[model samples]
Target: MTVTLSDEARQYIGAFEEETEATAVDCLVDDEFDRLVFVVKAGEMPKAIGEGGETVQHLEEEFGRDVELVEDAPTAEGFVANALSPAAVYNVTISEMGEEDETVAYAEVAHEDRGVAIGKEGRNIKAAKELAKRHFDIDDIQLT
Candidate 1:
């Protein structure tokens, strides 16, 4: 289905276009959750990121909304990750189930790569927990 944009989102898109000189075609708003999602016709994700994701960061600051830009193309890794969150995980090992019932998982990558697996300030792991709760009814998911 064609995505729709709110008036505020339209304004954000306009501002982004003006500032970054990038064309944005469609946007969607999750009104209940107050999230803004954007779709770009341009095929390249790096171009969308635009010099350290600066364009998106600026737009997000201006809009004061959670903005997500998704490309139309289907990617294999993304497809697998999206399809298997909560159930199937990558580069993580279940290390311990504690007496308190909290579980710990360690990333199987190098120490430097831990941040990539766990994400910034553990947000990625938190998101993984939410997905796990939804799909598997788990209460806790931990990442090292």
Candidate 2:
């Protein structure tokens, strides 16, 4: 389905004259409730947000609505990877092994996050493994 913004939201976007390129504002209605989400080009996030998020804060307060501004990236995968914890997983490599063609993926997590990587009673790590297997088709996960 297509998403559109209300006329009131358009007024907010026009307020930022300093931002040359036009940014996109969307109003979403989910099963739970309605929310406003703004999508701006990757490099234009700072200008869209203004200093200390004052622009979005002012808009939210004035409109009496929740607004979330998200910076759009070229690829959805790149966006997901970028949004994931960079410090925790510095590098990830995948390889296929054995005659059975099993996939093995290794993730290099930060030393500080060793405990979290392993998890309390290994529950977190197990969950991560399940999610990785589901999303990336990696049969094995080796965290270093």
Candidate 3:
């Protein structure tokens, strides 16, 4: 699916690419969370983040909001796993269920890292769901 970007998001991507010298596939402007989430091309995360996270820190300071980076994946399962980072994801299964055949990603996360997967106030899961829908047309993400 083609992901559409708002003007503001485009501008953010431009700045991020320029500063980090990395390619960004998508940017999510989450005003509710007061942060910008950038999905960079696979294997470009280190370059995007820079040494000691200085690049990300600089971008956050320049934009005046928290910055997050999620590595893009070629498959929905990998993408879902990347979206729920900092948590050990054992597996990801994408399935279509129900009468309408809604697509869902069931992530098998480490039992001990459930809180991190969910994030504080559910922000992590929210972002994961939004990204999944935007990129893969998935209806929802459920952590198991």
CA lDDT, candidate 2, residue 36: 50
Please provide TM-scores, in order, for all candidate models, with all chains considered together.
0.44, 0.43, 0.99
| Native-to-model Cα distance after best TM-score fit, residue 72 in candidate 2, in Å | 0.5
- Candidate 1: lDDT of 6? 65
Name the TM-score of candidate 1.
Answer: 0.44
Worst 10 residues of 1 by lDDT: 75-84
Task: Residues 21-61, candidate 2: write the lDDT tens digits.
Answer: 43653322221323354555568777767788787777667
Poorly placed runs, candidate 2 (over 4 Å): 1-22, 25-34, 81-144
Per-residue lDDT of candidate 1, residues 66-114 (tens digit) = 6656443243233223322323346544433658665433433445554
Cα TM-score of candidate 2:
0.43
lDDT, residue 91, candidate 3: 99
Residues 47-121 of candidate 3: C-alpha lDDT, one tens digit per residue: 999999999999999999999999999999999999999899999999999999999999999999999999999
Ranking by TM-score: 3, 1, 2
Error of 1 at 102 (Å): 41
